[model samples]
Target: MNNKVITKEAAAELIRDNSTICTVGMTLVSASESILSSIEKRFLDTDSPRNLTLVHAAGQSDRNRGIQHLAHPGLVKRIIGSHWGLAPKWMEMISGNQVEAYCLPQGQMVHLYSAMAAGLPGRLSPVGLNTFIDPRIEGGKMNSCTKENIVEVVKFKDKEYIFYPSIPLDTLIIRGTSADPKGNLTTDEEAMKLEVLPAVLAAKRFGARVIAQVKYLVEGGSLDPKSVVVPGDFIDNIVICDNPERDHRQTSSWYYDPAYCGKIRVSPQQETSKAPLDIRKIIGRRAVDFIKPGAIINLGTGIPNDVIGQIVKEKEMESDVTITVESGIYGGLQSGGIDFGIGRNLSAMISHQDQMLYYNGAGVDITYMGAGELDRNGNVNATRLGSQCTGAGGFIDITQNARHVVFCSTFTTKGLEIELNDGKLNIVKEGHIKKLVNTVNQISYSGKLAVEKSQKMHFVTERAVFEMTDKGIMLIEIAPGIDLEKDILQLMEFKPLISEKLKTMPMNIFTA
Candidate 1:
């Protein structure tokens, strides 16, 4: 038998110091946890592979499980990631300027891998234009220590675009569901294909060593040809995790669920548990009213993923309105929070690279997302709010291209209280932190760009709904039993443009 399989420690030894290593995962799905843990242990024991660079598209940690294992100061010198909310330890390191960091759009990061595979100079797109990712702004730099420019501006045919230069990869650490004796990998048991294919291709192009971790190893010819995701010829080492239930979980919350991997289809009734009537439900109820029949929509993580999805299912509009998740899932109920990126009863599952192409090219009809901060210029700060930095995970790509944008958030955060009685809203206590401000700390969604493209933009809260117009945000509707001046205007940091024909939000939305 050809010896292509190795232990996780042996695979960890393949990495060299100061080399660029890229990984593939979304939260906890397909995270290669055994490999990551081994690498961390090897570094701690010998301190051999120090000052390495880590690159990942999605946030690949459940606080301390996945990539957070390498959060030691010398283990990683630089991090090129799309999101940072989950990796709290690395967030602290980046905040303290202990490591240099640069954040890029998640879609563009996947596209970068493809470009690297093709040996292209860079990947060009309009995904980050006019946002903080544009070089004119922060250039996706996270700390004062990061000096190199990874994102650039270029003009093509008199139009502007953001160019992400390809960074040479030295090592690829990826995960899969199974592997054959010859090293061919398959993802039949994984929830998402993620960016493992492009990552391997990129590593092969750069002559980088590829180390893959899988849950199972089978005979060479037993696996079907079409099931192979990465050919054995492209991989250098394969590690079969001994304890998959702990290290190779399907998601952060579950060890393995056949429904997540499309092995078994679940009923819509089982997936759709009605959310209790609350502020989020009210905001979701109001937001869903804007969707037309046959409209394809994208749902983001927070309120949009949970509340709006529940409302859509409760309304039985799954057949009428198509729902797509950024994780390349189509026509399935998306799980919320840490269990995100996996779903049940999925109609189709495509690679994230291809799914991003659809989002960047033709785009969706509308996208309902959550917002962290909103300013007077209509810019949103979903990535960075105060000291909490959650990098834009496809938020920039989705919101920038979508024809219509609706941001669902509470009027304030931290500690706010409200009551719903007899189809009216009463603010018992205002939130300590106001989300609406004069200027957002970071721009995740450019309100000016939305207005420039004539895209419809709406901000829905429990109390009121505001529309982004040519002038600014205009108060178009207010909830019943709410005082316009005390509960609405006084709570905001800036006064908004009140519509001449302001009306009350439909009372039915407040009903159970």
Candidate 2:
């Protein structure tokens, strides 16, 4: 194996048309942006690949950089990964029938690629059983409207397991801090401790090419052998990016710094809008009823984003409460403030993975997430709604591990009318449709698992609040100004069991 270094352009040329490529990175972190830009430039300069299949545990860099330049405009045909939100262009491509997008479970995706790298037949896990990802539902179905690949139930020793096939890789693109002339690499500080080494090894074992983008090229024997993550023996080409700015905080070798923000800079514009209360705000405020003092909470994007505002306004809990994001950021009170605060003293910045590992270990006492569609069986589909589907992001990990989970959204979207006057929400016009459905197109997180784990779960909307019980979804409360029969009952796909002690949510939530 030669330890030769090349230009980023040369590395891009190694990727041929119609090849299966695996990108190494999680959302917004450790993506090889320089290499991705080079690929985009190459595609623009020459004939682009057709029917290219991208395989990865997550589409971190490809979606953000590659999709806009090459992958989305019909240049690429197939995408197999866990989530799709990081790349807006790729989502559009999938929706337009220009590409085939297959969604896989997060943990299962990691296991699948690891399995392939190890020369295994496939991966067997209990993650996707009884959900839409189940093969029985759609055989991991993929279409313009749907993205999930079905999970198959295989009974071994009378114990059921979901089987996910191993997918071989033709090329692996990874980013690291530095590479020795001998090709030894290190990712000691990278975000997720991603299986980049195994991915590169998988490609190498299959006689495929491995391309690595690094900030610098060191002497042949410069890098400590023990510190090397992917040795030169496995790497085929090394591209020197030279831009230390891009490499420093991204490679994960550097200590997590408060000054280093990602490509998307935190700005006031991106902050969740705060104004007069609407149906969404009403639902968010009502979710506060579930919060307890001294609880650690994780807030998902969307309606749940509004909960922080309500919490701050209400001052409902003691000062011991903590709030976190799914990205693994913690102690950041993000209550529609001028800037999202972080840590004590409102530090507003923290290491990303630290938050993920915390939630992964079920450190969060409660979690609030937004949902697109939910069923009587308590399955929630927040990933895809109509023509819009955001990646699961950290929804699965947060909801699965949180002690209590709350799904917050309006009873129906699209022209739903509700107004706030005198600090109270008044439903003027109920949206003529229901967001709660008989079945969800995809199950982003399993409510059954929440029940089995004895975790409390609630589906809270402007119209009603339903709790998952041993029997099923039970109506626990309705909003202050909602009509129980006309608004809540008629809109639900299935009849919700009304609790004998159902009550109206408090209007003066700030005082509650």
**Candidate number achieving the greatest TM-score relative to the actual structure:** 1
Candidate 2, residues 1-512: lDDT per residue as tens digits? 46578887787777888888888766545677667777777777775655578876654632334334455454567777766665667667766777777766555665465577788878886556655566776544446444545456899989777888777678888877678876788764444345566677667767788888876677777787776878788887888876646533342223343323321334545443444555556677678767777777877766676455445445535366767664444453343211111222233333343454566664588888888888888889877767654556556656777788888888887777777665455677667657778888777767677678788888887767889987888998876666788777788888978899998777674122
Per-model C-alpha lDDT, please? 0.89, 0.66
Stretches of candidate 2 above 4 Å error?
A: 1-3, 59-66, 117-119, 144-151, 179-208, 216-234, 242-257, 260-282, 292-298, 305-365, 389-403, 428-433, 445-455, 510-512
Residue lDDT tens for model 1, 289-403: 9999999899988899887777888898988898888999987778988777778888899998888988888889989999988888899999987766778998999999998
Question: lDDT winner among the candidates?
Answer: 1
Local distance difference test, candidate 2: 0.66
- Of candidate 1, the 10-residue stretch with the lowest lDDT total is 266-275
